[model samples]
Target: MPIIIQPAEASHVLPITELVNLFAAENLMLPRTEESVRQTLADWLVAVDPDAQPDDPPILACGALVPLTETLVELRSLAVHPSQQGKGLGGHMVNHLVQMARERGYHQICALTLREQFFVRLGFEPVDRWSISPKVWQACIYCPKFHRCDEVAVIMNLVENPQAAVHPLARPAGWNTLLKWSEWQPLRLAYKQKQAQVQ
Candidate 1:
């Protein structure tokens, strides 16, 4: 059967959600809400089975590119249905997204994943998670394993001489004191209380 890779449609939502959540259940990836998928719909790509039977689903796989900065993006919510694994669907979807990233002028793409070898096979190099950007930490702070994150960071440069375009700012030694979400929880609660009183 022919596989079609294209920008995801509203009809692809449930299949994509199910594939992602399958991995999320094993803690291999983060779970996504339907609303989050809807909002990032434009960034998503789906691979469809062109010859599916009338009752069979059309989508076989899905993934998305999440922008981290002007020159950087992260590959998120990547998954292939269990029945479809080992058939190169994941690689095909990944290559499609990489092509899309380059076409959009993004210099680098990264993934925080447990499957480092899988990404390496696709030309990604391992990097320190901190080396990416603080924006990644925004999501990390919400993760249950923030202090003990186990996911390795894999990076791939789609542009020639990628190092030449590295952002000029020096990478911080560690997360800044102010950026720790835990440090601001009290302030956040207090602000909410004040807003409630005003209302």
Candidate 2:
């Protein structure tokens, strides 16, 4: 099926929620409520047959680019309809969002994903989950599985100068103030808690 990648519109909310929650039901990804979807609908991208009529596109796949901090964004809630699986639609949506992030001046994009290899194949490198800023945990704190979260963090640099765009959570010279450390400390705790549970 021919599909186009485009920014999601207001009318796309219900289908996007349904698609995301389909995977959520199977423990594949985080579930999204209509309110949550509505709140961030502007950041979402939809894969649909462009020939379809106005206001009711059949959203074959969907995802969102959620800004986590000034220089970092998280790709969350990526989903593709089961019938459209393995057709490279999910990858297309991801690349589209990555470009959007680049254009918007984000230095890095990351995702907490169970499908680490899939993102890896798309040029993302796996990183320590704790190595990400705790801002990534805002939505996570609301999650029922927060105490036992099990998602791998993967990141890709959007800048042409990768070295210049250091991962936001990396500690650097003179940056050891309490405020900075406190801001990033939570993910380390979350990571260790998950690690201890495994052992």
Distance from true position, residue 11, model 2, in Å? 1.1
Best by lDDT: 2
lDDT of each: 0.76, 0.78
Question: CA shift at 191, candidate 1, in angstroms?
Answer: 15
lDDT of 2 by residue, 69-157 (tens): 67778999999988789989989999999999998888778899988899999998777776666666656765767788888888887
Which runs in model 1 stand beyond 4 Å of their true positions? 163-199
lDDT of 1 by residue, 1-199 (tens): 7889999999877778887888888877777888888888999999888788977766788999998777788998888877788999999999999999999988888889888999999998777665555566655655667667899888788776554333333435632111111223433444555557579
Report how far off residue 115 is in candidate 2 (Å): 1.0
Candidate 2: misplaced stretches above 4 Å? 51-57, 162-183, 187-199
The per-candidate count of clashes, in order, stands at 0, 0
Compared with the true structure, the alpha-carbon lDDT of candidate 2 equals: 0.78
